[model samples]
Target: MNIYSDLPDSHTLGLEMYQLISDLYPICRSITGDGVRKTLHVLQQFIPLEIHEVPTGTQVFDWTIPKEWNVRDAYVKNNQGIKVIDFQKSNLHLLNYSIPLHETMPLSKLKEHLFTIPEYPDWIPYRTSYYEENWAFA
Candidate 1:
């Protein structure tokens, strides 16, 4: 009676893990948002999680809790009216927890805020400005 013998094969387990990642990869998770709640909800299906919520502006250590951010849509368009970056195509196109703003700026100015990984030029970098009041797109 070996419990190990009842487990799925390595290949099957790998496929299941990959499928789970694929399902969760696209979720727009942040420090606080429906995305985070949704992710926790999905995870709760596998393991019990005690979800807790602290009111905005609650003091924690040296910093006060900032407002929770959630974006429904965001994008940047060139002067000619073509979308240069669209959140719809990829959430990476928008910085996480970005304070919503709609403004037209020159490409040079916008480039100042853009971040990229020189080592992984083709990869969309994961970035966040949790404590700072700023935003950027990878």
Candidate 2:
């Protein structure tokens, strides 16, 4: 189900990364807890999920659900001290799960883990490591 924007008409993803998501699960999968609930809610229009909600800090085995990182905006400046990338323009432009850091380093060091797809520069190549901790410009 669409949340921030209108749901696309088709159920198949396109060659592009953005289209892939909608193309695949127009009515399935859990992109978020709320997204999951919304999907299941739609299914309840035919079936049900008997869903459950766990409070913050609740632990299950070795993993505990994290407090959602609803970042409205973020950005980084170059060594020249220029704000090159602004997260406010796009949430997917960031390295998700990155530790809170605001220091500057040289271009050589900074570009190590940076992700930039020249073939699809217009598309923010969304990357994440829910279980890892390394951030870079992409």
Candidate 3:
């Protein structure tokens, strides 16, 4: 009666999906940037995806497109010079749409911008400041 009942084993399909996710998980993706382009390119290998690059300042509805923000690298180091959070390890370490900055600040000051879900302390949250003039790290 159900079309899904005629499909292959769910375990096999789940394994295949997990493999696909593992292959693509490391890509750094943002609303607009080379990361997004690279992600789409990888996805295109398995599926047909049409990508369009709208120029900055283009108007859509009542909002104008913001300039593309592409990050090559970002990190936060402790006062002792050990990197506590490195984007190279995971893109999630860097805040979305963060402007380029390199400065040494005390942990007390930095903590103000850090976010965490108390209910899931071990999990990192994906954050974005696409329209706000601010930055945050998860």
Residue-pair clashes per candidate: 0, 3, 0
- Ranked by TM-score from best down, the candidates are 1, 3, 2
Candidate 3 lDDT over residue span 1-138, tens digit each? 788887769899899889888877888887788888988888899799998889988999998888787888888888788987888888898778877777777888889889788999877888888777776677
Q: What residue runs in model 1 are displaced by over 4 Å at the alpha carbon?
A: 61-63
- The weakest ten consecutive residues by lDDT in model 2 span 23-32
Residue 98 displacement in candidate 3 (angstroms): 0.9
Question: Pick by TM-score: which candidate is best?
Answer: 1
lDDT of 2 by residue, 1-60 (tens): 658366444443233435444443532222334545665665565455687777646788
Candidate lDDT scores, in order, read 0.82, 0.60, 0.83
The segments of candidate 2 whose C-alpha lies over 4 angstroms from its true place after superposition are 1-52, 55-67
For candidate 1, give the lDDT of residue 83: 84
Residue 82 displacement in candidate 3 (angstroms): 1.2
Q: Which rank order by lDDT, best down to worst?
A: 3, 1, 2
Reference-based lDDT, residue 115, model 1: 82
Model 1 Cα lDDT, one tens digit per residue, 47-117: 88999988889998987876787879888888788987778878887778777777878889888888888
TM match of model 1 to true structure? 0.83
